[model samples]
Target chain A: MPAVVSLSNVHKSFGALQVLKGVSFDVAAGEVVAVIGASGSGKSTALRCINALETIDSGEIVVCGHKVHDPELDRRALRRDVGIVFQSYNLFPHLTVAQNIMLAPTCVKDMGKAEARRLAEEVLAKVGLAEKADNYPEQLSGGQQQRVAIARSLAMQPKLMLFDEVTSALDPQLTGEVLRVMEDLARGGMSMILVTHEMAFARKVASKVIFMHQGKVWETGPGAMLANPQTKELAEFLSNDL
Target chain B: MSLTPVHIEFIATGALWTVGLSAIAFVGGSILGFALALARISPVPFVRRCAGTYIQIVQGTPLLVTLFLFYFGLAVVGFDSLPAIVAAGLGLVIYSSAFLAEIWRGCLESVPKTQWEAAECLALTRWQRMVRVILPQAMRIATAPTVGFLVQIVKNTSLASVVGFVELAQAGKLVNNTIFEPFTVFIVVAAFYFVICYPLSAWSRSLERKLNAGRR
Candidate 1:
């Protein structure tokens, strides 16, 4: 299977400070890649670059046939092929859960209200929030809101999904539920790139794991590599978590 | 010089102009103000600067001066003999647009940055993201202030009287001159202004409470 997402030597800088020095990775169709790293290690920035949320200063990123680094790239088309959920959930506070999920489909895809609502129901059920469709984001717990955020992205039916520290804000119990939803998504053969700190979940579900250190992809392999770290940084990162 | 029912009726008719003027100014100002707010946040540096300069100038100059500028200043430039109503309406539109633009811009900014990013990730166009995701959220933040600003617009229409437009205040002054009962006539006029402004004040407060309730 061809790679659904490929990042080659991507470099990004924030004014005077360099965040992502040289990062590269690839994920094939139906592959689940978990990018694990310490804060400021550029994992999240790499994920953002894949979606063109953070423009790369140099290097190349191609996601679902869209060349993301090009200035004249069809960004909207690239975005249509990619769905991203943030740590903040970012659900529209004024909209009900169903409305929040349905917004992108109805507006971007020009899907009819009935069709969007049906899609919302299906995605909501996938995230295990089928009954909470009419509730607003503020009314839900952090886990529920994050699930709604996931379902919102799923409604777009994108070929690739990017999650940037989605459960970082939630407590342990809430994180469990969110991790379960993601596990289900992986089981369903969704192509995913998750920037996460959930080591146990990453070890269990991620088909490939990339450990980033100081703006570089220091180590990567199957999930088993996390258990037997070859590098001192990976071992140190794993130790800090425990 | 006792006040007659005919004079009361005339003043009542003037109140109608006050309401009509407020409506025109508000509707026109809201449209212009929305554009200005968009300009205020535009990615283009020149557009943002121009919008900033407009807001600063309009906000700095008193509305009374703006009214005079449009009413008398326009005539100086050879657009002479414009009706007092036209002059007053134009002045209010300009005045309201600047303030509304600022109010709306603040509301738009208050929506979290994550909302914009999430919408972008969905592959929504800029317009789609704004109209569908951002504006609906901003509108909730904007309602209290926008409605509160309406009271200011209605009260300020009284300034139109100075330019020979007979809105509520002008009508009151005219009735006061004839009856020579400054206290009673002006009191009635004040009552009319109060009648128009108080409900709007209450409505704005209620909206603020409702919107804040969700946050809590």
Candidate 2:
């Protein structure tokens, strides 16, 4: 299977602090890749680079055939094929949940209003928030708003979804609800790259897990590899992760 | 002669002109101010700097001076027979647009970067993100200040009298000149200004309260 995402020798820095140094990874189509690492290990930066949120100092990233590192990148077209959900659940406070979901479909895709409404309904139901459609963002709990954020992205029918610590703000119970929604998406075979600290979820649901340490891919293997880490950096990380 | 019906009628007409001048200033200012605010935040450095300098130059000068510049300065530079109302209206539009543009730029910038990121990731073009996402959110924060600024606009119309545009204050001066009733004639003019400004202030206050209520 062709890779849905591939990053080679990626390097990035913020001022003098180098965040991603010589990082390389590939996520095959329909693959559920979980990136786990310590804070400041460059996991989030890698994910952001994949989406072109941060320009890389050097290296190449291709997502759904869009060259993210290229200066001539059609960023809007690259974005059309990608969807990202942030930890803060950045739903438009002025819009209702249904309006939030319908926005991209109607605005970007130029879908008819009626069709956008149907798409909103479909995505809302997928995230199990159909009844909350008319409510404003502040009217919902954090988890529900995050679900709405996910539904909003899903309405665009993206080829890949990037979840950046999406459940970090929620309580464990709420995290479970969001994680379950992601699990359902995984079961439905949507390609995903998530930067997460949820070790148990990563082990249970991820087909591939990449352990990142100090801006490089330290170790990578299937979910079961967590039980037998190949390197001491990853072993120490797993011991400390719990 | 003491203040009479004809004098009251004259003042009323002046009040009407005051309102008309304010309307012209506001409508023109809002359109130009919206453009200026967009320029202030433009991605290009040169565009941003150009807008900033224009706003700075207009804001640093007094409203009276701006009125003078438009009314007298244009003729000094070789233009012919400018209308008083046009001069006053031009001055007010230029002055008000600088202020309105700054207020609106701050409101637009206050929207969180995350909201912008979310929209961009949704594949919204630069124009779509602004019109569809950013503007609606910024307009919410802008309403009370915009309405509050309307009171300033109405009050500032009195300055038009200096340009011989014959608004409320000019009419009061004419009545005062004739009746020599400084207290009574001016009191009536102040009342007229009050009548126009009070409701706008009250609406701005209530909008502020309601905006906070929504947040809560």
Candidate 3:
């Protein structure tokens, strides 16, 4: 199968600060790729570029065959196939979880409310939070809110899911539950590009591991990079965490 | 000179007009303000520029001057038959629309960029994202300030007296001229305004407290 996402020589900058320096990577269908790096290493920017949330200064990014940053590409349509979860969980605080999940499908897809509600139920169940569908985001714990965020994405039936530091905001015990949901998602053959800090979860779930440093791809290898360090940067990164 | 009961009755009626004007201003302003706020954030550069210019023009001018412009200027254009209330209403609508638009724009922009991305990820169109996600959150923060603006509208309606609308302030002026008691009649009129505006100010405070209670 073709790669679900491909980024070639992507360059990005914010004013004087160069956040990404010719970064590039690709994820195959159903593969879980983890990007790890220190703060300000551009891992988050790379994920955002795939969805065209952050515009790139130069280079080509293709997700599900649509060229990101092309301006001519049908961005609204491309976005439908690319789902993202933020570190903040970013649920609409005013909306109930069910409404949050159903909003996009009904409004953008023009689906009927009844059908959308049924789909929301199915997806919420998938995230293991079907019981909390009627509650607001503020009513849920950080982990539960993150699960609802996952369910909201699942409702879109995206071809590729980009997770940016999903568990970085949660406590350890809550972190495990969210990780489990991600693991289950991986097992179910959902292609994902995860920017994460959890070394153990990265080792277990990723088919390919990438380490970034100072706005460049520092290293790329299999999950076995956990045992066999390639660069001094990677060694120092993993050492501090473990 | 002493105040008569008729002067009190006239001032009370004028106070009622002030209330009525405030309601009209709020409803009309909100309808236009929401559009202006949306325009301020529109992806199209020209639309955003036009909206910015409109807000700047309206906010920079005094509402009293606007009332005169609408009242007298329209007469110069051969529509000399328009009622004072209609002219004043139009002017107040324009004035309040700018202020409310700025208030709502601040609230809507306050929503985090992440929420927009989350909506985009779901493939929501621009309108859907705004109506369903952004506005709902914005309205929460917007309620207190929107209500607070109503007090200003009530006070500003006093300016309408210059155009002979005969709302509360106009009524007070008519009574004060006949009664020949400046201090007594005007004080009663001021008291009436305090009565109407004070409660609204207190309610806005209470709402702000409720919204902030969770933070504490």
For every model shown, the clashing-pair count is 0, 0, 1
DockQ score for candidate 2: 0.58
Q: Candidate 2 or 3, higher DockQ?
A: 2
Give the TM-scores of the predictions, in the order they appear. Answer: 0.95, 0.96, 0.92
Which lDDT value does model 1 have at A42?
A: 94
For model 3, the chain A TM-score is: 0.98
* Shift of residue B196 alpha carbon in model 2, Å: 1.1
Q: For model 1, how does the per-residue alpha-carbon lDDT over A72-144 read when each residue is reduced to its tens digit?
A: 9998899888889999898888778999999889888899999999999999999999999998889999999
If you assessed candidate 3 against the hidden native complex, which CAPRI class would it receive? medium
lDDT of 2 at A146: 90
lDDT per residue, candidate 2, B1-216, as tens digits?
A: 788989888888988998899899999999999999999999999999999999999999999999999999999999975899999999999999999999999999999988888899888988999998898888879988898888899989988888788999899999899889999898889988988788878887777666543254
Q: What ranges in model 2 sit over 4 Å off?
A: B202-216
Question: What interface RMSD does each of the candidate structures achieve?
Answer: 1.9, 2.2, 3.3
Candidate 2, A82-188: lDDT as tens digits: 88999999999878888998899888888998999998999999999989988889989999999999999888888999999999999999999999999999999
Q: In candidate 3, what are the lDDT values of residues A21-126, reduced to their tens digit?
A: 9998889999999999999999999998898888899998999989897988888888789889999998887778998899888887888999999999999998
Ranking by lDDT: 2, 1, 3
